[model samples]
Target: MAKATTTIEKRVPTQAEQEAEALQEVMSAVAKNKDALLTFLDVLGELHESGALDMAHGALKSRHQIGVIGMNQLNKSGAQNMIKNGMNTMQFLAQLDPNKLQTMLGAVASGVDNAVQPDAERPQKKPGLFDLFKQMRDPQVTSSIGMMLNFLRGMGAAKGRE
Candidate 1:
């Protein structure tokens, strides 16, 4: 038997073929989302009717002037300082432990609530030195003192870090 002969050919897409493929893909997508596209057009028509489209066009035209004015304002000393302070505040907040801050805030809120509420049952009396000594024995007072001491230590350690 004579040996069989085979030929293989590779074809590259032409520009026209690529454009046709793109058009087909777009048409397919449009067909799939016909209702959505229609609804979007209706909403756009309503926006055009409301004069918002004109405002947007005008804003775009004045974008360069707006940007220049914004930059001028930011260049002012007060604005610059405000931005710096804001950035510093953000950095400070980022460094803090969220759980510890939350706990501290909860305690502060509780203290505020307690201060706002009137306790009629307890008589107001000035505590003597002995009363102060007695308070030191309380667990809550001791815990608060320890926390204050640690806070002072941390504050001291942060010296020169700025």
Candidate 2:
């Protein structure tokens, strides 16, 4: 019969030995990721060659000055209005039905394309009142006029609210 051991003895490595173990692990990792390490070094080399690294270092060193300049620019009235207008436009767009907007934009594009044709290709004579009345009687033209009226109604309602 064999006697079983009841206690475990753990050996704590010395600082130098621990450092050596860490170095070995790092070396193995470097060897395992040789291609990635090389690619990273290549990117770093490119940045250095392009003077981007130097610019970044300088920017970091003078971060306070850069921040002040940025703040001053942003404080300008034009910058403020630009930011405000952009936000308002984004908000307005977000509120619209995407499908309807897309359709309307496509219609507008086609209208522009039709309007820009060479004079020889299009009717040289401006539509007479009778011709315009005939066009208004067309189903497509009637539908567009209805859409424009609805848009005007919405604008009127918005104005009332304001």
Candidate 3:
């Protein structure tokens, strides 16, 4: 009987080999696109210097439209996970230093203020009590309120026993 030989092929890449291959691919692409990429960056810088970029973006409704486009690509679960991850990451980053935490808080406050500010210095309309009650008619809102009430009641009962 003839002896049978089995050859096992290794499929996993070593970390160093993977890193070298990634670096090679990136360098190759950079070499190929260098001129066009430089030209694009120059044009972007010029636009920024001229204040034309912001005006163009505003005229094209780019910010809100791009946000909507990006949001549409996310499923509910993906968005929820992204939000959870972002909050967790922010908390971790904030804990890094006191200065970092203060900076982040300031940025958040500025963002909130900007969002609440009206366009062209106009005052925004405050919703009436009826309008607020109308929002409560939403099933999701009502369910969330019910859950919150139950939690509060449970806390109150616990306190009573103490």
Instruction: Give the best candidate by lDDT.
Output: 2
Q: Could you estimate the TM-score for every candidate?
A: 0.58, 0.63, 0.29
Report clash pairs, candidate 1.
none
Q: Which TM-score value belongs to model 1?
A: 0.58
Backbone clash tally (model 1): 0
Estimate, for each residue in 71-110, the C-alpha lDDT of model 2 and write its tens digit. 9999987998999899999999999999999999998897
The lDDT values for all models are 0.89, 0.92, 0.81
User: Judged by lDDT against the true structure, how good is candidate 1?
Assistant: 0.89
Reference-based lDDT, residue 75, model 2: 92
lDDT of 1 by residue, 1-162 (tens): 987668767899999999999999999999999999999999999989999988999989999998999999998879988998999999999999999999989977976776677368645577789988997998977987888899898898888586
Model 3 ranges off by over 4 Å: 1-3, 52-162
How would you order the candidates by TM-score, starting with the best?
2, 1, 3
In candidate 3, which residue pairs clash? none
Ranking by lDDT: 2, 1, 3
Residue ranges of candidate 2 with Cα displaced over 4 Å: 1-62, 118-122
All models, RMSD in angstroms: 7.8, 6.1, 21.6
Give the candidate number with the greatest TM-score: 2
Cα lDDT tens digits for candidate 3, 54-159: 8988868777887787778775557878889999999877767788568657766865776677466544668789977986997856875876697699789989
